[model samples]
Target chain A: MPERSRAHEWTPITLLPLNGGPDPARLADSFLTPTSRFFVRNHGTIPIVDPDAFRLEISGMVRQPLRLSLDELTQRFPTVRRPALIQCAGFRRSELARVRAIPGELPWDEEPVSTAEWGGIRLADLLAAAMPDDAARHVAFEGCDDVEREGRRFGFGGSVTMEEAARHDVILAFEMNGEPLTAEHGWPLRAVVPNVIGARSVKWLTRIELRPTASENYFQRRAYKLVDRAGATTDAWEAAPAISTLPINTLICRPRGGERLCPGPIRLAGYAWSGEPGGVAAVEFSVRGGAGWRPARLSEINLPGCWREWTAEVDLASGRHDLLVRALLPDGSAQPADPAPLWNARGYMNNSWARAVLEVRAD
Target chain B: MPERSRAHEWTPITLLPLNGGPDPARLADSFLTPTSRFFVRNHGTIPIVDPDAFRLEISGMVRQPLRLSLDELTQRFPTVRRPALIQCAGFRRSELARVRAIPGELPWDEEPVSTAEWGGIRLADLLAAAMPDDAARHVAFEGCDDVEREGRRFGFGGSVTMEEAARHDVILAFEMNGEPLTAEHGWPLRAVVPNVIGARSVKWLTRIELRPTASENYFQRRAYKLVDRAGATTDAWEAAPAISTLPINTLICRPRGGERLCPGPIRLAGYAWSGEPGGVAAVEFSVRGGAGWRPARLSEINLPGCWREWTAEVDLASGRHDLLVRALLPDGSAQPADPAPLWNARGYMNNSWARAVLEVRAD
Candidate 1:
């Protein structure tokens, strides 16, 4: 075996449902987060599937249902490589849960995200072959992994609008970074939809359904939404859109909170990203507790659906200091400064400014 | 002249162009903000409109151009009364400006909004009468007021998509609070587009145009947009969407910051409003700088496009304290606690938690 899964390094939020945050230092400095260092997020149990027998079924409001094996899917369709950053919608839930009570949610910290080159066929080409019906407005993706919510067991599933399904970057990938996806990651086949929450990037792919409305799957219909009210009526849940378009965000990696630092010039680095078409225009840091802000340089090479690395320099004194970073999107939306305003019932999409308190000492 | 036009009590942001914020204390108590206490926001000099002679033109991408007098407009169409809370997109920009310099735009505080019953003809009905062409996707509103920007004079103008134009609350108002239109308040006619930024509701209406794209007016195309970059390219501006949909916000009227009072049980009251369809579902306040947040009781009577009064009581000790309030929208979005993340180049949509510091002094 080529070493072992990077499960040990990950801080476990839950073991059975399998969600973990990666060690920030190992994952931070690199542009493409290694598969081993990538954080794992799953809503259900990982299933064992036979690669030869695995068939991705495309059905529902299409002219005809399709069941294609891995060979047929890879050989028959036009393949493309897409680089995408997958983030749990609840990436910074811990920060928000600290400020407010987001009960029942696994309090995710600043990990649950990583970038990789995914090899797949464009979902559009596959949809075109399937021939969607005129009335089909949504396309649902179902995974083989069984997820239990409220005692009933079902596959972890989600749906996207037909327009979203047709985006050039939305794909069904079987490979990550030139290697076949590991079991912890989506194995055999998986959807690789960039720019949206990772939950929509369903794994252990089994079935795809085109429908007139959104998927009735519990994950799509009830969960993965940003409803502010508790005990929301079915109508309220119906009205809310599934969380999409990752907000402008920054991931501070080098200066880990509470890490010991010398009282001198220190390197500040992280990745800035957004789902907005304008992309991340700038990433700024405020070492003086938001009293002042200075711009950080973005990586010269940047791509959509991938995080751009950012670096800056700041002088630190022998004291405790909280460094703040905010990503500015060209579309005019920026990250909020405090987590208190971003507190939600589900603790999802807490794209507030990334704040890390550091300890500067004389060693 | 209606008690000196209530101008003396208003705080002037600009003198000649005439933008002013109403006294929040006076305007806060009333559900329907009185005409005298209504905040005035103008981009250009108020023009003297001759009601009888003035012709409202509906042209461009239509079956035929129309020029109807006020009498024809009122007598020919079905008149309706609409009550909407009109808020400048830059409301609470003053708080953001303190954190970051948002040059050029007016620094409006929390007082640039008020609600009054508007009497007018439904804009949808008017468009139906004009017989818009299928190619028309937008409806442009042109005001009589002359606004000069970059040495070019253009009537203050804006455009709304046909989807927004067809909203039930969009109207051409000739009366405010049952009184005849005032010069500063869109003398003869004004477009009252509820649930949108106040700028889209062009006052002193002179003409309307149907087109395939948005208005090319300075306010519509360039201004009133959220672009985080400095010196954004023309293409960036073109790609950026104009600011619309007043964010969920709260206005804390009682116990203004820096007011001295005895430390004891104090009553807190504010108005929460939203342009979103679900409106403000809940309003919450925290006395201890966001250590915790408690719910505030919403008023019994609430209306769409109008603020709902909320009240609460908190026991305080003798010292300095800060009060923060936030409005929660049913759509799963909440206000930010700090202004840093919401700070844009234009300082628009500062829906961060409303913060007010109070001093408790022994009497």
Candidate 2:
């Protein structure tokens, strides 16, 4: 196991942890997470590395394999900065736990995600220099941390197809919010594959390999795979494709669950996101179980690969109300109205409509 | 003059000094400015105050004239947290500099504004405890920072109607972003009146008084006024009313001035805000100089009293494109199409449509 290190530590808040489902009650008026309040998700022990000695290796099917130091990586390539969102694939996995009472890993509440301005060199630029052959189909990433789960030992590893990795959006991010990466996050270096599952964007990244075959690591093959329960058959994990782009999803960030609102025009606010390159196309909200849908006013600020905020004003006539928020992707994809449809064995990628309950008072 | 602090002290990017108009090319990606990057517009010097020694005096027409230290204030009332956007009445004032080139005052770039999560005691709760009579018309706020500008010595002061101050949105904020307020950003305490001009939400707030009349301070009476240039006028400052709620406005933040993009799908992002209680209703973008307007995707997240972010995706054929963004308030009020229609002598309150240019290449 990698030596555990505390890179970035923040004071904790006293709010109750909502299951893996997002608690709309915790969102503040500003869309950005306050530094101390940001959620954390770690697959393995955080690694401590000396920045001066840190090196990133680009190997595998490249004509010229290269091991470049941190200084050389930044100094040699043109630096680019952009805002991106990094979200755990099982962000609300705990919600599945409540539905089936099934056991799973990472008992996360509504935290485990964050967005920031990441500065780094483009991975496409780096790969261009190494010149991988056309036959290379996937780019695999390996982090320094090691994990032991249920008598199985494995290093943190994942892979993305080379086509997605070569897109201009991917980067070898080394800095968050203008400073070097914090330890809790992958310090020194990390893979930032925009609009992809957070698991594939390995932190504490040490190696990048261009391979004709996809990664056969446990994380890639066994853990993150989705299976069919009705078929009553066990298929090899390799048969399943790796989760890439996120689906259209929304989470109510205010009025939280089990909260009350004064009877009047109450502002309903939440965040919506999609991994499709076209961005969020639309968001419709309903206070009455999708009986009537009203278009929400979407935030104008677009931070690349980050979630977009949206809000709607609904008048509650002194009663119990169920507020639901669902988003549409640029490709016309909308979140499933119910979570039960997407429930799986591992509790992964649950992109369902987010609902909240608010008791409204006339006074 | 108050201490003339150098602008952009902590930022890596060199901000172009405020001129008469926005360059159209210098837009940033995120809507909120980093604290170090936020533009400062001071009519007086920043008052340095020791937090331990700070006291807020609440007197005038109230039955009880209360003097409370910062600690006493926190302990005495239930703390409330809200996100608010504080905009200078003169934000984007330089846009007025384009048409008439008005003289005097700092040449503010389009900035002169910011938003933050403020934690403090509710003004409504405090005013209720003070037992003010119904006869009170206005509640005035005074800041500790005194200023000498244009041969006049004045303290930053403003007033809101008694009914407005009694609303739940007004707060005497002592903390910003989960930390005690920074020295430069009115440490110890400040007043936050959502949707109002920044002038009314007095920073370095020291005193609150109930009055039968409005505040007659120079900032309230002479400056921050809107004028009708088309009509006959005597003194340029006399005909205008004190600036209050901001009009519906939008700003494009990315593909910053002079940035290039390849011909394909170009994603445009920006922020929109209004001073009224209702959120922004809609945002429309155009790439052909208002020839055709398309609705941009708005973020679902809406923090109370905070700016809303919006985004749009456009497929651009290879060439130079002029992009324009306009916002509409919840009341269906849209910003004027051009600054020419909204120009005033003092160069204040320019809420014209924001525009930008991008050159797309085939590569």
Candidate 3:
């Protein structure tokens, strides 16, 4: 809520129940992430609303159930803009809670991802003027934030999958990085959905229904699926997978996890994506952890669901190492070399092979 | 130029015959500044033009000189935006070139200031359609690139005082913080001028003229001015003065100087300003070097030539220290507790009293 520290000073951030994120070595300094060093996941606890009395309702399986108002949803739709990359299906839940304890949530390292440019209109143009029907097949959303947990009161919900709300890069954002939308982001609306998983991009938004399934809420059926343990029940959290797009990753934002290297060359860099008919293709790097890798260079921005900005230079020596990083997917899948058999239980997508360490020494 | 490093890792920037800047501990991490960590400064090179054949011109003492283009200066005037804070009268010229040896130049350090938003068009609505001439006092501007130095071939120029170019917060910029202008900034025009001296904000802009007495080019009559030594003569730089606005400074941007601290309650933050009707008004802080200081808080924006955001907490205990900081101004003037008595001869405004150092240890 403001107590959130670590915007970068050799990374390592943790702060608040607000879910602090970032420290993929300060996300390798830039490819856009500066909304105060972006990364603050939040679930409930942050609702003040009132941007001239907000509004937005839209009712379920609609044929006509609107509500509107934030100046009639920004002067009747039509705005659009993109830039994507959202991240945060617990992006690296602290490397799966250091491989053991996933306890009461909040671990997420690698700054819950960023990349902005949003702007709004087009949740399929407000579900095509609220005529949705044909028995809607999922689109929920919610969020005026409530959060109570084992004591009842809820709010932050989610859904999607009506072909991911008729993608065209989803949207509903009310601008970000072109301003207008700051009340801890979601000043007038918020649901961007690009590349998915940033908890379905909801935030202060007030409902949106049109469903026929997939919104048994509790964070669209038990906190972003992919279960295996941590108190599951409810039929193994509705048979696993509910984490929309975002998968083939890559990160290592510079030699920054406790960095202290010396022995020559280095440089490295970070970012890399995927999510949607396979996106990022090739990002490799190793330094020993994977035994042999190399090949970085990327940056001609691959787009489709964003992220890409790599680099290389290698050549070290002196001692302590680790390093890693991975990614390749354009359907070629890659990125696995061990996340301890993809854990889960609530730590969500820990991606795997991203490592860091360093130490070198011996000028 | 992509080879420049340390944009962060606890500040200390310096790179480029292209001038980089930023390490007033990363300019206290935000209150605008970030066009890739702002603070560039370049006086030569980086000018490729073609924002669809930009133009500008306007000509001296006008009656109707004109030229315009860039879509007739955005459909003839009216844009405006503002935010300001430009800095760099060689911001702390590397602590007055480590107190002596000024030599050729570039030692910069303390990141030549930033702050943005800009946007454009109101050079008093293009000097009210190029009418000017009632013995127009001083305007000048220039730019289109060039820059050779110890062998001649110049270009970047400057001037002002047509009552600081008809105030209303100067302008002429063509957007920044909202895109449009990046060939390392200065794409289709530049000249924001607010609170002056950023080499008079004259980027790739080409000509504006008017003048009557100040700007005989060569960096407006023998480079930036101020006087007191380091290779003076041109009649002591035409008898001193020409360094426009900016003065009551203050920096520090969080612990960062040789940081290493451990002792206890540190915090401290940074940024402070004052240019025009002497703005800032209070910022203090110290830790031995200045004897006893304290008071910091600030940040309700204040605005005058901008900057603000301040903080403080202190406490310490173990070894090495230093710290400092300063400011106060709204006419109370304060800030020179020693930058070695404000050096000069091209190390322009150092302002002094900022310090840093740190190093505690002992957990």
Candidate 4:
């Protein structure tokens, strides 16, 4: 049984089953999310692992299988630090869930994502020592968390393409925001995969496998995959490709729904990024419902696979307004104008145009 | 002797002498500033008062002088609640302080202000019973706090015009955010003069004096006044009229100065208000050094003598740029484009155009 812990201070307006993100008002305070304020996304009970007894085993299609303890792993490899923004595949799932009765995953609304400074040994460095052949096309990671589904027990697992694992930015992070990971966010070891959907960054990591194909674990095989909007059968599950990168996306942090706004200048702030090669190129806002768009000022630093912060100031008059945000990606693709066309089971990859209806009163 | 109390939770970024305001980011979270996050502007030590023994005495230019206990005060008059934003005249004084050596006052920045829900007996209600004479032109409020300066002991004091005090919004507040005031925030009662500088909202209830002219108390006569920037002499201090209504102004809450921003959409959020009769009419933003300006979306509720929230989304590319915000009052006056014209010796009333230099990097 998973042990219950004291409540976290960073929990925002939460949804059910342990999914919450920091309020955007607080998120905009700094460039990096402090450990106390970082978002927590957990699918199953949090496992309490003793770091002294923890070991990460590397096997599957490698020249030499090795088991390395936490201390040994740290002392043996050169550590590298990188900053990345990890967004959940189900981010903005709340928008989709609103369109229909999409069941299964936790309904998220721009809170399942956060940016952090990660430090760890490069996964590629260890893989090179183990010497995988050309047949090794993917890398799979498994965690100690036991998630029960339909009375069957299985561990949380995920995989990424070999090319992704080889990137210098992809690290096996042990330190989050310059400190050891907290138990709530995979204390001992976890993979920090940048620019990809958060599900692939498996937490509480216990094993790494060099494989000829993607892992067949429940999450890798059936879950976190993009499927047809109408398909809910086994055949559809078997044929769909696993969801990997995030689509061009934007999230409105201010002027949240149901808020009473005064008539004057209001600030619209949010985060935007993409999984495409060049990342998010531009983010724009439209006060009118898709009729006009104004470019939001982007941040100066645009790292591949990272979300950049943007800001703009617009004058608002007394009335209700539909504030819209859209992102232009490096691949020239943009968020769809409407989410109804992309609705799918499990509410995954619901990156449609982001809008907030604001009430501007002139009291 | 002054009382030392436990630290307060609502203090903003500070310079010295213990004056602070709400963080704009936190202030933007909701319409009302939480009690724990409200701004504190203290020139001297906070007084520890026994609420049971607290009495507010009303005298001077009235038909019948009256002294009422906390209990009697509550029972005799109807309690009213009002939501108002209180801002220090020195808000954004740092912008002016940066221009030159403006000494004596705490070096304030983009804080020194906050909005709160205050509940108390209206001064008007109590005064109606006292029946003020025709000679009363101003109402002076004196506090129990003993502030020592130049080896003389005197309490903090200020006054408003008789008509101003007669307004319904002016209250002897005993509760903040639905709870009794904290020790740090003038526990038993404090005068809440709406749409005025915070100094006028004297903390720590003691005595109210009706007078034929504005109070000659040191603060009312020598401090909290507008003076020419070049006037640093006693002559300048002697000639200037005490500062009264706040001018139209705006503040930038997010993208705080000296922050690292990435390339993408950024959100500019802030608070705006005018002490003039009609309140804030509009707030505009400029990135091209005031060559062109864009309007920000204002919140719907625009209360008189209170600040309204505003937001705008502007697209920005990678580079260093200056962002500016200005407010337009209902009376057709706008914020000065440059702050240099408003610089003063005490750094009071520094409501020039608010500008923040942001570094937009493409890392």
Candidate 5:
């Protein structure tokens, strides 16, 4: 269960699963997105399990199957905090949808992406207690929320390799921003896997299963792949690697859209991030309709798995303008200037240059 | 001193230093660029160094300075063969020049790049014999050729991190394609530093100096950097990173422009390469302007420091067409679509989508 950014500020992209987040303009003002401003990305209904009755079951390819109450899980392991970003696979799918229609998927704009401090018990300690078998290769998680998709009923599920699950930052977070988790954000328990698509961070989590293979959940097996054609054969879906790391991306948050301002020098702000070990090196912004790009100064040093804020100012004469932003990766690659090249069946990784249309009015 | 590619077939971009390579269409016909067709990128006048008098001096931050004659370099070290690609920093500058003027620099058009089998001794073996001190961080290289610029005459020089220079593949190559090197190709000896810009390879090897910092040579400190403005301040040049690893790039060699073919299905071929550890993951091509892109089939599994050949076909129905190719890197980034945003004072790393135009007419 994920919490809404703000009661009125939040706009639901999907009502059935209650998926939504705060506006982009609201995201530019702070180094860390406030807990209330964190995006909620749900694939199913928010589960309402009580903390007293909540029991996280550890089973599958482990030598011991243990059930721990919330108190036992919190007290047995030392509490630590990790600040990281959570971005939906379709964070900027709307831009892609403009190139080609994406049916049956939410047209996410610059929402469903935010950073926050997560306090929790390290998943490695819990996995060690369970005594995972040597044969175990993947750690699969199942949330309590009921997801009814493709005319089938099942709990939301996903997985990560054992190597990733054992990482120090991967945790079973019970608190966010120093407060107990809200119902919408996996109330009593949840799993937070950093530097990956948000779908793998199962919210309202209750089950942790270790297996010799990846989880067979539809989300992990079929939905998250970068398939090019619609209704691809099963082999195509299975052969395609599941989307793991997100691309280096940037978003223009200020002047979110359709804004009128007096002509003159105006400050623009945004955020850029990359899941690669070498995070975003630099970001450039253009107000000249892709004619030229200028570097934006970044504030705060970039931390591993965290996005950095950037700002730039440009003088605008009275007129309409299409502002664009793109990130430069350490590999000497930059985000594409057009979206048509990035369009795919699922609209995943639409890291094409982001654009915001602005109208500069004379005083 | 470097032999021209079949004389009539080679078109010298610059006559003084003798810079040129075979037409790219000749490159796509073979996986390995023929030794005679290998690109010659010289920054100065090739020197006529007699083999007996050619001494490669290894000094600077090393415990013991050692000078080895050509005979000693060969007799003391075991012979090895390594296959690698050598790409000029201005391989596609002509493409960028189309978007913005690039004065003075050669307008390279898919030339100045090639691959060949280099036979020589591992640079690591020489470094071991020289015993570089702990304080040594960079390995600088200088050639026997004479370069004149800034009212001063000096040898062309550049450097790489000691870690990169010590790679198993970096070699002091004396043979190309199992034959003695031509004077044009650094007859006595040349250093082949794999995966870096060709500038660092340093033709006509004369010196290897281990240093506490990067080489102060004009090419290393100022010329090969990615400066945005003309006559950049010394501080700007010092702060900017010298062009090192080449970007993931693709070029269409088939139908090498100005082709008029009968309307029908036509084959397209090219090469794609990246300097990243995780090589080029995929390459996509477009025949419909920039409307859509299709995956191209790559041949000969990619090897470290080498480029892979790719081919695709599209139906052309009695009209003009602009074929384009773009490479996808493992970091989830793609070659940019337009060159306008990549405009810089020196047209370095213009990895925009490569295009080749054709006029398909009816008989």
Candidate 6:
């Protein structure tokens, strides 16, 4: 029964589920996955929670320590809904597998992702109610999940400066897909930090603490680190800072490799995303490996934190071709041409230029 | 009973309802209303539709006369959803009331508008299936509603050239707000041409006829026209082409006229929209009329056919201040500085600059 419940908790990919995790082969579909079908990454067991009984406790360096029920929170403050994309820092970990066998953790291909409409009360409202001490600088969130790293065990915890937490669209979400939160999906409540790494969106949220220093958890401090050496392992996790907003990335979602398309006007569609609040600045696609590029018409409806859908109509010639898709950030940073340059020991944060090969035939 | 039903149908506001018919205000609380809450502007009675029995017949200059049911239409073709803003050409007709007592239809003050997520099959897909003949020039849509105008009777009808209907994102929407269309708000299905005038979104869609000419209905050719005459009773409707995409416009939704604010940093919020598919190019806010203007931070999420939310933080001193907001389109057109220049006999298509006055208190 427990295994059956776990199976139900797992979201299935309808078109093409990642075999072991995510892989480059899955790039044929448009990168934007419907909210229900997005991949989930869990550091610990999913907790069962009751919305009526949920209480988010605010304590530590503050003038007032308060515990508010979900009902009280909703009625006392205004609610805002924003679209945001939540991505794991270790997305595309499968690229490291090609370099060398890194035994540990899920051999995540590239599926560590999803975007959703998050509606909730702002964390700033809670801070206003708590009245943090003048010296307090960091706002840390502790989740109910526990994980072991190396030989030490700690709760899944993370923190950001108080100033970062006060941004406009940050929220505590209690729903997904217009329904109440489900177990394995942060049942009662979860944090939704738009344009930030998914690790910061602590699920099964239990407590929020305002402190003068950053979080001291193993997961927050020692794991999820990216090192410079490709094959070298290191205990220098302390040196790496926690990931925040995602860098620019693009994925070609249709016309799989080796697929034949009759020569004509073909509508190309895909998704582009960035962790920055400004959204994707630009997306360019090339049919002949990096030879010629054209801009994709971006969807006008850019919901904050949600993926932007893009489309372009191309007149394909009868020939074998390799297609490449790349994205740019508002700051002008682009995906690297190859994944080899970003290779790291932990196999985290792989945002390389994505490519697909196809054959075009005469109509 | 009729009066009670009328009361339920109309949303009362400070300005008189246009056309001496249903009230323009909606019951929804949000600043932008959902499709169900949007005011319907029909020149004819509501058309009762049977969803299961309904058939959208495509004929005339088409190579094939195709009849499709709701289920078959949705299942056979891909579905598309996009956010679109629909506004009556005479949204703020009551503003003309201040200049002169020009009696007009739908004395709408600030209502007669809304934005909604429309989902359905694309008109392009249906047109592709029908495969119009080489000489087919225009596509005409006739609604089921029956009406009498200028001593002539006809069904609500309109048409766009084949080139116009083939544009991307033009859809035949059967659902709004994730639900089936409501009775008064065009049940069964309706045409939604993004970035086009409200009249083009013919409701109660019954038949689509491919023709070689434009629509000839009174509403299509005679009514909803924009003429340029200064004197009272001069018809401007015949002078200008029928209204389609909205002119660039801005609305002051907060800190309304005569409102009071405290001296300090005041946040200004409003909505701006453009009828062009390119969307709003820029929006500027002026605290002291047009002395010095600052660009408001436009909504990063630029959804097509939807209004963009803009905000600006301005420091205030203790005094009275006149606030003005104006929008610019991609083509460099702006909302006229004065409403008088755009006023006409029917008082339609007013895109005057928006202004609000407020006083700031030191305390």
lDDT per model vs. reference: 0.82, 0.72, 0.74, 0.78, 0.83, 0.70
Candidate order, TM-score descending: 2, 4, 6, 5, 1, 3
lDDT by residue for model 1 over B1-363, one digit each (tens)?
121132345677787788887778666534556566677899888887666679999999999789999889998876665467899998888988898787778878887988876778889888999999999999999998989987899899999999999876788998776566677788788999988899998998989999999998989988888988767887787788899888889899887887897989999888888888888889999989887889998763355677777889999988888899999988667887788888777888888898889898787
TM-score of chain A of each: 0.95, 0.89, 0.35, 0.93, 0.95, 0.85
Off by over 4 Å in 4: A1-17, A229-231, B1-363
Model 2, span A50-155: residue lDDT tens: 7777789999999989899988998898665555777778767777767765454665545656666566888888999899988999999998876666477666
Per-residue lDDT for B1-363 in model 4, tens only?
A: 122343444554443335666556776655556666778887676777877778899999999899999999899986655566788888878778888878766777777788776778889989988899988999999998878765778888999999999887798998876567776678788999987888899999799999998887788887887776654576677678999888888888877767878878889888898788888889999877786899997764454555777888877888877998999987668888777778887888878888888888888
Comparing candidate 1 with candidate 6, which one achieves the higher lDDT?
Answer: 1
lDDT of 3: 0.74
Q: Which regions of candidate 5 are displaced past 4 Å?
A: A1-363, B1-8
Candidate 2 residue-wise lDDT, B1-363, digit = tens: 121232343322222222122232222423454344544555566678866778898888999888888878888886655457777777776777778777764556555566655778889878888889778889999988877655877668889999789777789987765446665667677888988888888888989899998887777766777765534354566546777877777767776646878888877877888877676879998899888999997764454566777878899998888898999877777889888877776777788988887888877
Q: TM-score of chain A for candidate 1?
A: 0.95
Query: Candidate 3 has what TM-score?
Result: 0.29
**TM-scores across all candidates?**
0.50, 0.52, 0.29, 0.51, 0.50, 0.51
- Tens-place lDDT per residue, model 5, B270-301, is 88988877778898987888768899986523
Candidate 6 ranges with C-alpha deviation above 4 Å: A1-363, B1-32, B229-240, B331-333, B361-363
lDDT of 5 at A275: 84
Tell me the docking grade of candidate 4.
incorrect
Docking class of 5: incorrect
